[model samples]
Target: MAQLAQSITPVDAVVSRMRALDATLPERDGVAVFNRVYLAVTEEVDRHLDAGAFPDPEAAITLDVRFAERYLRVAEQGCPPACWRPLLQFRRHPGVRPLQFALAGINAHIGHDLALAVVDACRTLGCEPADLEDEFDRVGDLLISMEERIREDLMPGPDLLQIADPLTHLLGSWSLERARDATWSAARALWALRGLPDLAEEFCDRLDAAVGFAGRMLLTPLPD
Candidate 1:
């Protein structure tokens, strides 16, 4: 295990962990639903990296690894942040649709974890968020595409798109594009406050709680 860990790239290792989760988790499990979506996004990003798509593949790799590690850490831990609590708590709730599960996970990761991961990658790479702008935007673009695909694949058909449908409201409430923009701002804010550990920690805590609240809303139960 030690030798294998040393040889494996961070992205590869994270992808492996996600795959393991996919294999073990049941198809209807909420976390598994999100895991499947995330695994696809990660693989797509990996392919981009291999194709030399990013202007700074090293920085992109570092950012991607750090970003994935945040999610994996919360998943492996006994206690995760508020942003992850909803999904973990409702992983098997029958009323929550698969689309809800997937989007809630995206909300938490993009709204909360992504910002912190940006700061983490910055510290590791010894560069500012601006230095990672190209890689960040590229990754964000991929995520946007993933989000679009998720909606298409998971969203109910036109028959279910009535004005009274709860899913319609839920979908309208959260926007990945907006979340991506906010995450960039949050990342820059976090980088600025890096010198003040207390303030930074407080900011993160608030962000986590806020994102968690949003996740909880996204996972709202609907009638069968």
Candidate 2:
């Protein structure tokens, strides 16, 4: 989409494609809100990659692209997992705040997509989760950093974020660190169940549903 050369790396391709999406989508659209947040993280990843931060660049690139592909596929199909469905359905709703959209997308991506992406990368690279741990941790750290920024940028002022504020309580309920830990555990579990496709599928489905439930809660419309 970016007219990238045939030789462009997978990571670059993913970044370029996201840039295109960011350019095309409406600013207030839910997908656009998430895209901006995600794009910032991806761009940071790209910077780190270029700076020789990742111990396994190839693995990092593969995992990053695979993870992003899950979300992109949903965008292309106009259909997404239960975890993502609520966000898409409410993308244009006026009651949903930008912060809600951003966090919901983050919930869906990190909670569900990251686990699957790890398995996908493992299969593609002929490696295991242990081998990708560094990449996973590095990416997770970037996400955590972005999460803080998202809150600071999208959250209401100090006075508005009072103890009784619903937004404050809502934001406090979800933790990116907790989600990252769970995703790592899920990836390990999924990898172990590779031989048992049925079990793995069930596990993934349950995860999707649970994540979707959280996302739906996060998207609860509030008074402006």
Candidate 3:
């Protein structure tokens, strides 16, 4: 269960707290911005999660992106963005910038996956499909903003060991296989949803399942 600590709701308290964290930063602005932004966003998210509003699928899906963006941004370069890493690793360079951009993209990917899970669960509801589509568009806009923001902070193009390999023999083993696997799993899950009316009840389960699959991947072997 990946601890799932990121926010799924975008609330005012989150923004306010993020701003406050940003305000308290000392001089020397290399990775401090990452630290401040991560704290502010995480605080904003944690503060909004209540029994009624947060645990619900709608709110959690939204805030997860906010949390992921914060984590990706603050993760300091050249490491898995764990809790304990030296501050000195966050060196500025033309290289290794794409890794940051790609990590930011991972946040968007997680949000997108969550949204799909929600929609799958809500397919039988009275809510029109258009509402889901509109919500997706809104999320897409946020993703765009994150992309632009990351681009501002990171250089474009591939670098670093963790960089996405688009032009390598690993594409088939790494990227395409994962896509195919996800597609097959999705088809099977959709098949399970057929002839079911209590879809709303199943959304969280499916969402969690999908998230768990990713969590397993993150736990796999990595270079030292």
**TM-scores for the candidates:** 0.93, 0.93, 0.35
Cα RMSD (angstroms) for every candidate in the order listed: 3.9, 3.8, 11.7
**Cα lDDT of model 3 by residue, 122-156, tens digit:** 44333433444443334334444454454345432
Query: Of 2 and 3, which scores higher on TM-score?
Result: 2
lDDT of each: 0.88, 0.89, 0.39
Q: Per-residue CA lDDT of candidate 2, range 86-175, in tens?
A: 999999998788888999999999999999999999999899899999989999999997788898899878876563288877878999
- Candidate with the larger lDDT of 1 and 2: 2
Supply every candidate's count of residue pairs whose N, Cα or C atoms clash at under 3 angstroms: 0, 1, 8
Compose the digit string of candidate 1's lDDT tens values, residues 73-166.
8766647889999999999998899999999999999999999999999999889999998888999999897787898899888877673388
lDDT of 1 at 104: 96
The true-versus-predicted C-alpha distance at residue 58 of model 1, in Å, is 0.6
In candidate 3, how many Å is residue 202 off? Answer: 3.8
> Which candidate order results from sorting by TM-score in descending order?
2, 1, 3
Candidate ordering by lDDT (highest first): 2, 1, 3
